[model samples]
Target: MVSSLQKSMINLTQVLRLREHQKSFKELEKLGAIDVYYLEAIYQLKEPTIGTISKLLGQSTPNTNYHIKKLVNLKLIEKRIDDVDRRVTHLTVTSRYSELINSDEDFWTRTQERLESEIAATDLAIFQRVLRQTIEIISEESREDTISD
Candidate 1:
């Protein structure tokens, strides 16, 4: 038995979440069909080995290599051979990605400003906590599923 106000709040939250997700999907699409996992892997390790990136991305070595090659060709990232181990290569973001990073920062800053203007700090804090908890719960569920399967 939810009050009308409470139901409206729920709907508003749902709409906000959906809009954010759609915006993120669009940003990724604009980034040239790059895999989110690969982007995340690169973000986590600014300059990482192909093996490390593959493991972080949960992709095969060859698949990761292929995608990285494409990224290299696009001039979005560069590959450098390890000094100690010439056979091993590491991936690093290229100068071409400076614009991309700036765009991402602008997007986040604008979104944060809007949220700050519209939402109370306490409300935003609570929402952030809930989002973190939800992610943790989902991760645990996924781990359990993987173990069982």
Candidate 2:
């Protein structure tokens, strides 16, 4: 029999992945995995260069460039050369991406209300903390795996 802990972990991933696929990532379904990472990092950095984006996402220059080209072709991101530095190219997402990343557009509002109503008030904070810690642990593991490779 599967342990309750294992089932909970599976459920967590299922719910999160379902939400991402159904909403936030629907328009982005055509993008590659690395492309998604670069897009998010670029969005956060406002406008960053190829090297900066590669470093931020812990990916190689050539690999990042490949995804950048794909995103550019899709018209989801824009690339422009710096006037002062002819070799420096900076990237920024188009307006569509800006709209996609808006938190208000997410199902989180309704999900939160449903969760609060279904779950006991006393356990909410504890659940939030545990969820955050779980994410951190997974992130740390990913970093460690990347470093090892």
| Candidate topping TM-score | 2
lDDT score, candidate 1, position 80: 91
- Residues 1-149 of candidate 2: C-alpha lDDT, one tens digit per residue: 99998899999878876766667557787976677778876775667888877766777888888899999998889999998999999999998878777644546778899889999987988999998998788666754554565
Question: If scored against the real structure, what TM-score would every candidate get?
Answer: 0.54, 0.59
Q: Model 2 residue 28 lDDT?
A: 81
Candidate 1, run of 10 with poorest lDDT:
25-34
RMSD vs true structure, all candidates: 7.0, 5.1
Clashing residue pairs, backbone N/CA/C < 3 A, model 1: none
Off by over 4 Å in 2: 1-3, 24-26, 32-34, 37-61, 72-98, 103-106
TM-score: model 1 vs. ground truth: 0.54
